[model samples]
Target: MDTDLLRTFLEVNKTRHFGRAATNLYLTQSAVSFRIRQLEIKLRTPVFTRKRGNLRLTSAGEKFVPYAENILQTWGRARQDVALTDSYQQQLTVGATSLIWEINNTNEWLEQVEAIQPEWALRTESLNRQQIPSALLEKQVDIVLTSEPPKLADLQQVRLTNFVVVLVSNEPEQNMNTIIGLPLVYLDWGTRFAVEHSRIPALQRAPILHSHGCQPALKFLINRGGVGFLPLSIAQPWIDSCKLYFVKNSPIIQNELFMVWLSSNEKYEDISVLIDVFSETQNTC
Candidate 1:
């Protein structure tokens, strides 16, 4: 099976439109159509149905989607493993969202990795929560540390720790009533938090101020006294120091953190070592 063709099929399935998938894959629409046709011929079944401006998957396509994803993932992992073995110095790129960076425990994990696996060349990047999974898929990063588990079919997630997402405010008196009416500094990754906590009647009407990173959100929370959810691990020091206070106890937000990598990478020695260190650190946290 051609992994490239399977990728094209997956992209088309995701977008549900040939043109859009072509744009995403940087392929001509005709080329995209040809690939799908080739795939259908190989399988001897129709994969999609064309309706009024909508492309719906056939039963075969629905069943095949996960299998296609697994194939691509397996291929990618195999290629990466070969590349790593061929290189003289193994390079491991790790990615994390800003929220993970602010956690003191995560910093400790990095230190432990350096002490334990000093020979491996390590590079780290901070990306938005949404970008971490894609970064891993593209092989731009080797592992992603995230508060939310990735839902992609090909990815494998290793649970780290569960943490509370608390609403932090500079002004203690603001609390729920007054804070809910103010401009809340919402983190870009806070959408899940918002949805989970939206049922809190006070938050439904709050004016939102969006920030791309956690530092800016924390700054906004400090300067403007707006509500934002932050991990307990990161916010605990501030709370203990009386720098930030919880806004309301109503919508208690909590999420599990995961160290995610391609499942095939689990066999690589370098990745295995890092995973063990990360797992130990998370357990301690």
Candidate 2:
């Protein structure tokens, strides 16, 4: 299988439009169409429908999508491993959600990595929760530390810690019930959080204000007087300092933090070292 063709297929699948996929892949639309046709010919099946301006995938495409993604991911990981071998000092690209950065002990994990493998160079980036899993699959990141583990095929997730998610409000008199009646601020990548909240019968009609980052959501809560969910680690200090208060007897949502990466890359020496370091740090935290 040609890796570039598979990548092109995945890109078209993601965008569901030839022109957009072409723009992203730096190819002309005609070239993108040709690649898709080539993939379809190789498989001896129609992958996409072309009628009525609809770009829907056929059944064959749906069935082949996951396998194509895995093949591309494996190839990318192999290339990265070979490239890392030339550096002598192993390079690990780590990604985390913005909420993780707010915790005081987050940097301690980085220091522990350096202590365990002094010859390894660590590259860290803060990504939105939605991007973490994709980053790992594309081999742009070696490990992703996130409060929520995304559901993706061929990935391994190790639980790092369990934390309580609490609803916080800046107003004193407002309780969870009253707050739910007003506009609520939510993180954009908070799928698990949104799913759990949607199950609450009491909040069925509540209006939501969506923000992409925790900082913006927090600021919105403070400045606009709304309720938002936050990690206890981040909200406790403010609660103690009388800066923020818990909104009523809201159910405490329990979230498990996970260190996720490709299982295929786990056998690599540098990844193993970093995993050990992260496991040790999680144990102590």
Candidate 3:
């Protein structure tokens, strides 16, 4: 059972054409055919139908599909664990929302925590809102840095900081007047931010640009001369320099950052130490 053979089988099964599969897998058609033949010989049965030009899995191959998938998945996780073993005593897989990592500077926060915990290996992931749940439930991520609490059972949320998002602009007038038709760069903070934002005035007239994360939205604002909601910490210096301004009477959405983790885990003792450090931090950031 070579994983490569299973992979080829899976790809061929997907494409239903040996040449297409070979193109996708970056191998020659002859090589792909040879691997499938080798697999059939090892399994003592043909795994695919060769009827005319139609390519499909045989009954035995159909039944073995799930098992092959699991084998590959488990092997992939094993490889990740093996790679982490040499450099780390114990790995803390932290999944952070892009807004937290890129905009709010969660990397600096992780460094502060890592300074105190020498024995723990910090592995950080910049995940979007949609990717966090499966990553946590599957144990690929041991900790979560998010603005909103996850609703899944067996998880506890530790409150970190409450921050405000204010409308900032790089327009020449640099005032509330620039908001209308300013090509608003909407960064997805969370559902709560969206709900809060709906009440703001002149937003209905805004030419919208949706961004997946904060950094790109901020960059677009600076480079293209638009108005959008940026974190207070992110927009402060520009606001001071007369390059950007707060929109008059714009809705200020307050969001809280949280560290979410499994409640029944032994790792919480070590994780609590990190949470405690966040709690003691100076709000200068």
Each model's TM-score, in the order given? 0.60, 0.62, 0.69
The whole-model lDDT of each prediction reads 0.73, 0.74, 0.78
Task: Give the C-alpha miss distance for residue 122 in model 1, angstroms.
Answer: 1.2
The residue-by-residue lDDT of candidate 2 on 98-184, one tens digit each, is 777665455766786787777676667677666677777767678887777778887777666666768788887666568756667
Query: Better model by TM-score, 1 or 3?
Result: 3
Best by lDDT: 3
For candidate 1, the TM-score is 0.60
lDDT of 3 by residue, 59-159 (tens): 99998776776577557656766777555667677888777886555766677767887667777776768767776876767899888877889888776
Candidate 2's displacement at residue 71, Å, is 20
lDDT of 1 by residue, 1-285 (tens): 988889999999999999999999999999999999999999999899978697999999999986887566557646654576433356666788876777665676677767777656556777776776677776767788776667878777667766676777776765677775666666655557657866677666545677656677777777767677766666677778888887755455767667788865543566776666556544534
At residue 285, give the lDDT of candidate 2: 30
User: Which should have the higher lDDT, number 1 or number 2?
Assistant: 2
